[model samples]
Target: MDPFEKMSLVGLRRYQAIVKAQLPIAFSHALEETTPWAEKALERLQKRENLVTEAIIKLEFGDDPDLGSQVSRSAAEE
Candidate 1:
């Protein structure tokens, strides 16, 4: 992979870690605010894995020209 792809991957990995770490606290706060709403929101949010992944990928890779090209080529090869 190119440098940009590597960098973006690193960023994505870090972002995932941060999100994972914060999720429980976020859910707890949400629950404290309201149980039923929190549960429903969490359910809907959990179902958006693909969208979340794509958004992260796009945010990480879209701005860098090198990463963008690498991603495009990789997708084409697949």
Candidate 2:
């Protein structure tokens, strides 16, 4: 991979790890808030986390045409 791609993969991995680690804490806080907005925010975070995970998988395992489309869609949504 080119330097930029390598860096991007590293960054994505770091972000995925951070998000995975924080999810439980976030869930607890969201539950404590007990508001629709809090639930919505948590849901958004989970969606982003899934995208990052897919991106990481794509990078690590080489391209999958379907995953390429999925990643593109996720990026567009962002």
Candidate 3:
């Protein structure tokens, strides 16, 4: 089985939080001109962050019957 499939809900949330916390650092690095590859790395990290966040939301609420409305409400709040 895949690592993500094996991860608990709490573990997935924690991992997502960790990735979010790293966004500031990644953004800062991306702003620097010294490292030519920093922007590419940051883009990859952002993509990973989106995937993890999506996974968390799916695992937490995908089974809910009102998932569409719930997601819309949550997205609005954000």
Candidate 4:
């Protein structure tokens, strides 16, 4: 078996059952704050650069075939 195929960075293996009992979809890789301020910053970056977009997230996880293959959308997407 591969070491990282199903690897989860932040799961508590010992307490997974307890945690799952409370929240069904606990995240593995956490995203930074997506507050209004962050959204505005993202917008500003997008305006300043051609490649800044939500699809970049998929590009960032490019090592994982499942996520990497999700592919990026055209920059013109709404």
**lDDT at residue 65 of model 3 (Cα atoms):** 52
Candidate 2 vs candidate 4: the lDDT winner is: 2
Candidate lDDT scores, in order, read 0.58, 0.74, 0.75, 0.38
Model 4, position 25: C-alpha lDDT score: 22
Candidate 3 differs from the real structure by a C-alpha RMSD in angstroms, to one decimal, of: 3.2
Reference-based TM-score, model 2 = 0.65
Give every collision pair in model 3. Answer: none
- Per-candidate Cα RMSD to the true structure, in Å, reads 9.3, 6.9, 3.2, 12.9
lDDT of candidate 3 over 1-78, digit per residue (tens): 434776788998888788889889888988975486888878888887766766666677775758845774685477
Total clashing pairs for each candidate? 0, 0, 0, 0
lDDT (tens digit, per residue) of candidate 2 on 1-78: 333245478899788778878778779879899988878878877987877766676786568888677666775586
What does the lDDT read for residue 37 in candidate 2?
A: 81
- The candidates, ranked best first by TM-score, are 3, 2, 1, 4
* Residue-level lDDT tens digits of model 4 in 1-78: 432234342322323334334332222112256466656655544442332222243334555765544443433352
- Which prediction has the highest TM-score against the true structure? 3
The total number of steric clashes, by the backbone 3 Å criterion, in model 4 comes to: 0
Model 2 ranges off by over 4 Å? 1-7, 65-78
